[model samples]
Target: MHDVTSQAGFASPDLSAFCRLDELGLVAVGQRLEPDRAVLACRVVEPDQWCRRCGCEGVPRDTVTRRLAHEPFGWRPTSLEVIVRRYRCSGCGHVWRQGTSLAAEPRAKLSRRGLRWALEAIVVQHLSVARVAEGLGVAWDTANDAVLAEGRRVLIGDRARFDGVAAIGVDEHVWRHTRRGDKYVTVIIDLTAVRAGTGPARLLDMVAGRSKQAFKTWLADRDEAWRDGIEVVAMDGFTGFKTAAAEELPGAVAVMDPFYADVLVMPMSVVFALLRGLSGAVRSA
Candidate 1:
């Protein structure tokens, strides 16, 4: 049998690149494929030489194995088993372990790539939570929590997401069916793309309730420049939304959304006639 340490010694550079461990200071020493999953064993490329406190040469004391879920490949869920070596200074008795931040966040179960894949799979590909969980080889709640946390950190928490807003839409949505938590949420959407004929509307934020205070407080968090850029606010029949917009963004034009306005003004006969005309036009096209 070949020594595990020497397995990736002559592995192709392409393979190393595909594994994406060089930047993390890890080299794949072994790989195993199972019927349902794959595992890539990695070791720190550079050994620790000196202690941080005393600047004395250190010796290897022990190693701890860290297993992280990696992005799936070849329809098989993949995992990375990294052997993190701990060093102890004989002079100062100081101890440290190999840094693995490049691979993942501290105490994170999934690698950065794995988290990003799960997020994109759900947001862009519209895959269900159960499907994403199976792809990552994790429990349903695990995948759900990780993906949601990542989304909040990367997308929702970022201040840049609120920029370039010219129009917005607000409505109340049933957030959670369970009685354990808040059942309703105020959903905010960026209608800039929809108004410009560029693409579908993008979700901007979600507040706790449909109350005027909730929406007003959310708007108050933004800077005056961002608030000034808002030209229009479209909402359903809810008067609270209008009140919130009027209070927070007095200059913005508040309009009834097409669906709600049609209901409020146009009779059913006219609505049916319009729908029939649209259908006939579609068939003609």
Candidate 2:
């Protein structure tokens, strides 16, 4: 009998089977590696569920449509054309459009495949979404939506499993550039042992504002276990973040390196080495 790992070797046909193609034509196109190890790529296509009001599948009086690309579940690239049909229910005469899918909302143009590519470029390669979209021959909205969607999706699971968080990093950057008004985003990082790998960083959250109230409310939502595990915080010299961390996570170390800047601005070689060191320390401790 072939060992499971041996059966899953790169050269084996199991790779293709891993990416199961459904009737709707979503295809798994790539694979990503993680240190802890999990399934590589397994893209599957699924049809949209019917509306409760009408009890009709893909039924429509007036058609409205949108498409979106979402982050891969594992190694599979994914995409969906989310359609919302405005239908007058034959039974009740009520007219309404259907709800959006949790995976991709209605009216988006990027496929889940496109989203994964864009995000991988941003997270692993440090390439901006704009550049990734440009290279992929897609629109700016597609790239931006992919980033936002992926960020939310990953954050949900990561937030649930987070524990033993000794240190954290809170920082902000301009998510979208506008020459005129305020367009900043705050990123909260969980520097914990579980995130010490080739997978994505321990992103706690991202919010639009740079306010004390916003950060305070956000910090207050965490459980005592996570809050207590945090021993140190490294952040830019932002008083709002510093204050929130101090107030919410008492007795936690606050490391302010005001001179350092965004992840994009840092050298890749240096960043990877430092991250590896952080990972090692976290794993050991």
Candidate 3:
């Protein structure tokens, strides 16, 4: 149990700005901070004007608290406790709760801002799923499921992501270190923007397997016109990837990725240096 100072009067600043409650049609009314979490009490700024069914005035009946995980504030997990007022229509007696869809999806655990932050942390910052879960103050499975679903819905599901592509790079990744399933996954990256000096490279797709058949099959599935548009294929020295590019895209120029090229050169450089030293006689001859 908290007294007045700990419950209602401790927060001296307008927390609405910190969490951007204004964007969600909410205003902070009170705050309570635990040693590890910050809890903000909020109320909806705009209640429904009338009942949707009867178009008559609604009389407030009761209130319910809706809990949502918000973006962390200064490394402390923050949550919003929204005070939602339920109403009953005068004419039809229909009941409804205040609108809060902007804050989150219906029954979603993470706020819209929180969801966006989690997605960016995973895709742009390259943070792992566990880190995202810790930042959101949610379970690991919950964070992973939500982020993957939202990522697919927002990015992978978009039809226009493949447009204007001219260059691609294929590589194998150790997707999982554990021993249960296939550990290697093939990642296809679009280097068109990099080649054209427009922007950084972007991910085009990912498929299972690390063989020539995997790369060739993925290329074959694309529209022939789209495949024809590729002007360059960059990859490591792995003949499997090189063979796939040659067979599927004969017209595209093949080039070694700079990072792999350095790896390949250092060994050759050492071998040649040792040969040159093997016989000061060899050079003199």
Candidate 4:
């Protein structure tokens, strides 16, 4: 036989090297790029899957292909046609499908990376939900739901975000500016980093109404450690907020924000000073 081993080095190009699916525990077996879209055929790298109940090794039974939306590649929306293998445990006779970390929770149409990309596009790039949906090749509701769920899970649900909070700012925001009704919300902001000159402030939470009860309830919900860590609370000239802070955060120093004080108090002080000076000048003249 003519040395067939020499041809091994001249084999076809490896698509996995370019696709970088290995980071998600997946391998690109094939690819098809078109003018409008691109499809990547992939398979999980895990050869051995265990039974859910028995914890025994599973044997391959068959494979089913599923199409999932992935992040766009060079302005073209990419889709992954993954071949998931069904397995049956030889010891316990249980059946299950191979799982990979490429996608979010099971049965989700969007991949984890796609969800992340959509969130960044909305929050950082300031893109609308419709535009993000269009870019991801998904419906508006699909994109909105995925982004909201992921944001809550990754950012809002993280309890560690409340840590290191030393200072806070509370104010009332007009949520609805219609003539029908005045709907206001109590907005709490973390001003620790801003006070320390380390980073910009971050929003802590928002309650439905602008009342002492609302603010007090929110403060009461926090753990003692978090409540104890609060040192300063900057707020507008709202007596309800001041009362709430006094009751809930006894050790915290409540102060009026400079903007409100300057606007409401400084102007009158300046006018009074000017009138007194003019009166004295009139008497002298």
TM-score of each: 0.74, 0.48, 0.76, 0.76
Stretches off by above 4 angstroms in model 2 are 1-112, 126-147, 156-158, 179-181, 194-201, 257-285
RMSD of 4: 14.4
Which regions of candidate 1 deviate over 4 angstroms?
Answer: 1-13, 22-25, 46-50, 54-57, 191-202, 256-285
Check candidate 1 and list the clashing pairs: none
Q: Which digits, one per residue and each the tens of the lDDT, describe model 1 over residues 1-285?
A: 765655756653454468676766678888998888999898878787689899998899999999988888765898899999999998999999888887888888888878878876765565666777788888776777777677667746877768799988877765454556666677777778777778656567767767888999998998899999999888887888899899899999998857433332322222222222222121211
lDDT (C-alpha, whole model) for all candidates: 0.74, 0.53, 0.76, 0.73
How are the candidates ranked when ordered by lDDT, highest leading? 3, 1, 4, 2
lDDT of 2: 0.53
**Please, what are the lDDT tens digits per residue for candidate 2 over residues 1-285?**
756765566555643344333322434345445442222332333434344666755435875644454434442333333444466656666666654433334455654445555656666666655455555455555566556666557655564646656666776665444455555556666555322443333556666667876777877888777788888777777788888888998978887654223332343332332222222121211
State the lDDT at 43 in candidate 2: 30
Native-to-model Cα distance after best TM-score fit, residue 18 in candidate 1, in Å: 2.4
Weakest ten-residue segment in model 4 by summed lDDT? 276-285
Per-model tally of clashing residue pairs: 0, 13, 0, 0
- Give the best candidate by lDDT: 3
Model 3, 153-212: lDDT tens per residue?
775587687999998877776554455766666777777877777876666776777899
